[model samples]
Target chain A: MRDHLAFRLAYRGTAFKGFQFQKNVVTIQAKVEEAFARYFKESRRVHFGSRTDAGVHAYDHFVYFPKAFELYTALGVSKRKSFLSSLNFMLGNDIRIWEFGRLSSNFNVMEDIVSKSYSYFILSSPVEDPILTEYFHWIRHSLNLRAMRKAQRQILGTHNFACFAKSSGVSVRNSERGTTRRIYKASIVSRLHPQMKIGQILEFKFEGSGFLRHMVRNMVGTLVQVGEGKGTNIKSILRSGSRLEAGPNLPANSLFLTGTKIRAGLYAPLRPQTE
Target chain B: MRDHLAFRLAYRGTAFKGFQFQKNVVTIQAKVEEAFARYFKESRRVHFGSRTDAGVHAYDHFVYFPKAFELYTALGVSKRKSFLSSLNFMLGNDIRIWEFGRLSSNFNVMEDIVSKSYSYFILSSPVEDPILTEYFHWIRHSLNLRAMRKAQRQILGTHNFACFAKSSGVSVRNSERGTTRRIYKASIVSRLHPQMKIGQILEFKFEGSGFLRHMVRNMVGTLVQVGEGKGTNIKSILRSGSRLEAGPNLPANSLFLTGTKIRAGLYAPLRPQTE
Candidate 1:
């Protein structure tokens, strides 16, 4: 088996079930692994940096394939299907491989100590942008940006975020494995332009050491409640450490994994961070 | 029927057949007319400022609906479905009405003395962006931007652009009427970002006093040829005034009617022009 290959990819998450493999339903991992078997004539499992929910887009999703790298190097003599091009060609219309490179054999996409950033987009107004419906979450009522900003500040530190996660409805060990996660940064910004007459697009960004299942969505839902003037005491909710105290979880369609900051010298940063 | 109503609208044209009304086909005009009939209990013939082909998006497509305004004013008791919101609620997810206003009784959408702007996006790379596949016209080979710029300048002034129009096979009048059009501004811009690893997005903008059928698409097709080093004597093609001399017409998906520059008192400008 080949070793030491990392791929930076992006996909529109509307079509697949999620990042994980499934039995009968289609998923991102299934499609990608099938592509590998078909194009490279090998079947190796792929490891993802983060497990995304259904309908959550990722602009910087990472994957590690040990045997795929060896297949690329060994097939260098043939020009039929180079590593990146061949895989991209075989994948469906919703997934794209942006960059690929050789990494240290020790590199692990899941356990790498770094940060990741996610953004949730909300279109606030009754007016609809038909062309952008898939990209934005349309909320008919106006949201209080000032209140949401204050709520974001209240949750920007190390805390036992048990309340922000959903119950797995199975064995509870998976949900309790890592409940104490750190929030490095959290803010809400408006991306509205003057030409946009009817509504405004508010982008909420969260950067953290790690995230729990549905944690970001639940936080966004709570922040939205604060913006709606429904939740006044956000610190109490955090202090309560109760999932019932938090607001409902937001939909996954509007969430995006925008960037991932990995350790130095592992791989080149995809783009310069403006913020 | 109410007389003085103008609507500024936009739609993602991937679903509809075209802008015009047809007997059995699903079209933007038919949808809008159906919405008016359903919401206002009246059917009125809608006139569009421009006729768009299938899969052509519009940022600011204007339409004049005579009965829609009457319905709003007559049913002015309810603020909930006011004029714009009522129609928007009735329309499908692929269409949106951005703005509506009362106009002069003599104002006509097709006869207005103004200019229109169009933008065509080209993703010049072999690798595809799955998220952006529906929006951009992907070209695998490298294009000569300098050569295309030169070709754009040659077709800029008042000219008989018969050479750059698609000929309707059935009748000659379809291609002959209003063939003389004025080109106000023409330029090619690069929307490339530092983070983009593989492809470059080139935006071609064309502002003209008027356009013939398929004029913009034909011009884009010819410019692409010049960029590909296939067409050098573009001035001769213009001098010849023959449709056979120009390149083929491009697809409709990549073209967008960015905005229209109407009379100063007609409507508000949608966005600031960077150039």
Candidate 2:
């Protein structure tokens, strides 16, 4: 019988080589799996709901393990599951596993997720913002939020997301396949970070049933170009479905996955805020 | 007669074992000298304003080359000097050289400073703040600002700060053998980060003629304990002249050098705010 384990992960990518597991290099997966391996005699594979690239951090990353129990005292079958928490504690600060639960055998993190929401942070300031240097893309030039929002609307809806995901993270082949996604929400948000001074910012949050490779990064990067008044015909760029037309890929520091696509079990159905 | 040649130095800490030039490990100074050897066809030496630790990062680092040069045009002298601006480029993002100036041979970064300041950051949140995670330490518990302020005041006067530094940081036979510092100002500051939804945060800022080894970190760590009510005897903790009673060292992420003591030439002091 197949059993599933769900997990939530967050990591800091500056010191890590990347999120994807590498045999020789120190990576998020390797670190986590190394701890898990110590608990179990046999190595168990972990399937992830999403994959983030080098230097990309995740607020939520779901993974399903097969009735996982790598680290534990020989209590009963039940105590094995509890060991995950203990394992997390030993894993240290750079990589963390905050929440865990059992998933149905058929539950697939990638397929079952109802929607994935991503945040593209753009920091607007006359001087380079020190705090956001790692969290958001800092643009020293003035940003026209109005223009960014105006261009944002053209991107929301059902479309071939191949143009955005062309960078394809680590698994280049999968990203090249392209994707069909429905954008449930999209908008530009502004706020002042509590810890910052001389603060001004613009954030792009979008939700979709699924995303293509690097899709969020490209969309935000293009929008930033559009915000800077550098790109022309963003609507055509969205429709072109070609990665080249989207322009350059921005830094991963400013991109964040705020939430994940969850199957309807615990969370209420999230509709568009305005609607 | 001695001629001062200004040199720009750049090095990756991880690439080298440490910052200081050593015979065994690669150092930033060694690399810069290598580059100079290629350019000048002669060996050159560089001097730094401060020596950063092994893992530390520097966005702007200035080094002086004893003699100025317009290396062969084809080999590129003017371009390389102007390339000083290029220091902010690439891995240089973490290291840079803004400008070069001929200073009196007597000038020194350590001895000639008017005042030196650094900030220590802490991410205080109900649920760990994902936004502030990378750049600062995560303090899950609440901090006692009142107690912290009281403790901060005790360190303001020009007193021997040796007790504040650690053996590793200052490396003295006697822990108390160090510089006496005058704290121009000390404050407990907290602000809302733009993206952080929940948390209490304060950045402790202090400006002083100089700093003891790990003094700011040790001070902030103790303040955190006081803020969280974990440590009692707040009065004695502040008034006691010994570092033994101070709090533990918070992570280095919380600290920053917001501003430096500028020389008369670099100073363009603003007029007092009109009431």
Candidate 3:
């Protein structure tokens, strides 16, 4: 059996093209693999739990490697500080590995059966936030939070999400495999962060069995439109299963994969319901 | 009388060397002046409320320019959007101008008699926070919050702060001006941010009449040392008035000038004090 290691990682995603490796463009995968090579003096392919798009952040994404455990054992815990700290020191400031442990050879981050949670941050402000520009999607007009919360409830069930998925690159064979997926939780939270110039933060959290390409972004966009009074027929849109009816896919920078397991309890319930 | 314009500005200080104009490197002053040149079709020097050091962010710093009111009058309220919005559009994502109004020509942002507040964020985490690297200073060891809080109390009220101020480039003639200054408020607050991988944020807030060069950073560093049990005699540190006696000056990135006026109310009180 191949010795493997599993780790929980976080990254800003601002400097990276995406999580995947590409020939020339800088990417999270490429930087991570480069760090591994330098540390162990051997090349290793790090497999990420999700192939996130460019500008999509991950606060609790997983990474698996074939020989990470062996390298850690070779270094020996008693000889140095934490393996996570050692790896983090070599990696750039934009990425960090927070937790790590040996995994059974048969386990795969992508194949693990579990749900994942993501949070999308939106700033409702006329003035831009200099510090938060990289982290939030700023919408000048005020959002009707109550309407958005009500719309998200419609998302909490197993349904054919083909209307929300990006279909351009999906294989024809996979399309027939069915686009139905179960959503465990969905909610929108509004918060006042005084320190931020754009003080109003609208956070949207979605947890589901699995997501198709561009599914969450499209869902967020559609819900935002509903909140803005542009799309009122959410039920009809779902039943029709037409991609064209969904809202435009929002930007990737505001989306963050926050948790993998349902019980991770990374986020609390949205408080003081917005009216 | 010449007409002037006043505005509140915010910036992420990661890119620029500092707030003031420099010969070659990019600075906030240079960028603001450049924007003015573009809009007014004339060269104008933008005056700032404070000369911030490298990597220090400002949320409520002021800026003023002569003939700004004249330009606004020319545009009128109907023809163009507010000068603040126009300037923000031309500036990079790291800086934003949020508020603007006409001011009498005699007004000077620097001479305004008001208190200014600054907050320094420190992440008490063994591992780094990828997304917050630019926003916080990461400390690995556990800190004694109670001890730091006690040290901050000593920081309150007026005192000769020579021990905390950096003396190296200070003019020899200005040394006799006396290093004593009034500190209106000082405290350390801890918070748990779920979105940040480094959950513990120890925010240090300091408000006073004015700060000497590197004053806040050096004070925070000394307090951190006290919290770590390395320095115990806070009284001696104050009495010695020797810069060498204080702890190392902390990095500049964690420091943020939060507000220029106490009544601006940009920050809320620390809730449920840390033990």
Candidate 4:
């Protein structure tokens, strides 16, 4: 029987190329796997809940390591804390494993995820905010929050999102799942940036069944165009299903994978199990 | 007769070696000077109200360029806005000249200053915050706010802050102005970090006549020691006047020069005089 160790991760993605393992470049998955190999004295295949692009941050992300039943059982409850601390020490400052538990052998990180939410921050100000350069997409022109919110309503519910997705020529066409996606909620709200005396942060939040490649960023880009009085028709763009019809893709730095939810009872407390 | 153009500058000092111009390494002063030279087409000496160390941010730092009256006068009120925009384009995203005007020829940036205030941010949390990596110093152990506040009171009032200053071998011994300085206010306050769900930010604020090199950082470090139950005696450390008595110097990235108050009525609006 195979047992899996599931963990929750939070990371600042500035230094990382992306969440996935890539050749000749540093990535979050590569670092996590490296740390896991060092700790367990062996290599194990790790599964991520979602793959985030480069410079994207995560408040809560899920990952699982397969075939770890025997090794994890030996550590027991007392060693778990030290194990996590050591792993975090190895992972460095950019990534942190905040929570971990035992996953049922049947649990699949990709298929089991029920929902995912993301937040994109925009600093709408005449002057660029130096401190928020990494976290926010600075816009020199003031954003019209009301217009963006109005346009945000159009993105809610099920729709064909090919206009917002990257054109993956053959794969997307051949895949069972098309460009259609269901957005549970989409909203835009403005808040005073904590650090900056001037300017407000426009938070664009989206909760969905799943997101296509560059979907959220493209949606935000379209909404930003509406805010900028660029006359973006989100409804028409959705219907057209043409990538060229959508707004420009926003940068990944300001994007955040804020939440990921999985089916309950799939995770068990990490402890020594007596058969 | 040298007329001055004064400006309020804000910058994230992560990329800067320091505020002062040094050979080879990039500094805030060097960047600003480069921008000035690019815009004005002449090498002009710039004066800073304070010299902050590497990775130290500033929200409201003051700077002045003497003999800039002619160039500034030529660019009438109509052209000033465009000029500022052009200069900001040259300065890039990390630094900004938010406000600028003319300074009276008699107004001395060093002597005419009323007070300066600085704030240091500390993230007291078990896990490191990745997004705030450049802006805050993360401490794993929980800090005792009450203990820190009690110790902060000892920093108020005038005293020889030799313990908090960097050792300047010949300068301290021969300078007419000694290490004695008056601190107007010293306080510590806790706030919920806007970005983080887990950690609370402890802000240490100091307002004083003048600060010695590394003074604020050393003071914060000693206070952190007190919070950690290290039994730091601020009074004794101040009395000792020995740098060794103080706690470790905190990282410069967490320190910010928040305010610089110059003498009132010293600034004149940037305009071509009707006379």
**Predicted candidate 4 versus true structure: per-residue lDDT over B1-275, tens digit per residue:** 77788877889989799899999999899989999999989988898769999999998898999878678778767676577668888998789876678788988765788889999999887667777768889887788889989999999999998899986311555434578878998888787655445557888999998888899999999999998899899999998989999998999999999888888888764421211
Residue A143 C-alpha lDDT in model 2: 64
Candidate achieving the largest lDDT: 4
- lDDT string for model 2 (A87-191, tens) is 656566666565565566666555678888888777765334433466778765666678878888877788776677764332445543347678899998887
Model 1: per-residue Cα lDDT at residue B156: 86
Which model scores highest in TM-score? Answer: 1
Relative to the unseen true structure, what is the C-alpha lDDT of residue B50 in candidate 2, on a scale of 0 to 100? 50
- Encode model 4's per-residue lDDT on A129-223: one tens digit a residue: 77778888988777778888998999999998888988631255544467777899888878765444556788899998888878889999999
TM-score of each: 0.89, 0.65, 0.86, 0.88
Instruction: Summarize candidate 2's per-residue lDDT along B143-252 as a digit string, tens digits.
Output: 66777787677667776664566643354543333445678888877865343334556778778876665677887777777677775553465445466776676655
State the displacement of the C-alpha of residue A160, model 4, in Å, after optimal TM-score superposition: 2.5
Better of 1 and 2 by TM-score: 1
lDDT per model, in order?
A: 0.76, 0.61, 0.77, 0.83
Per-prediction tally of clashes: 2, 38, 0, 0
Ordered by DockQ, highest first, the candidates read 1, 3, 4, 2
Reference interface contacts recovered per candidate: 0.41, 0.00, 0.55, 0.31
Between prediction 2 and prediction 4, the one with superior lDDT is 4
| Two-chain DockQ for model 3 | 0.34
User: Which structure among the candidates has the greatest DockQ?
Assistant: 1
Ranking of candidates on lDDT, top first: 4, 3, 1, 2
Candidate 3 lDDT over B128-154, as tens digits, reads 688888888988766889999998898
lDDT tens string, model 3, A130-189? 888888998876778888888889888988787888853345466443677789999888
Q: Candidate 1's residue-wise lDDT over B1-275, tens digit each?
A: 34556777789999889899888998999988898789767777887778888889887887777534555566655552465666787887888877766655556555564889889888886566776778888887678888999889988889878787767321345534357778999999976532335667888999987777788888888899988889567789878888888888888999887776666565432221111
Task: Please give the DockQ score of every candidate, comma-separated.
Answer: 0.36, 0.05, 0.34, 0.25
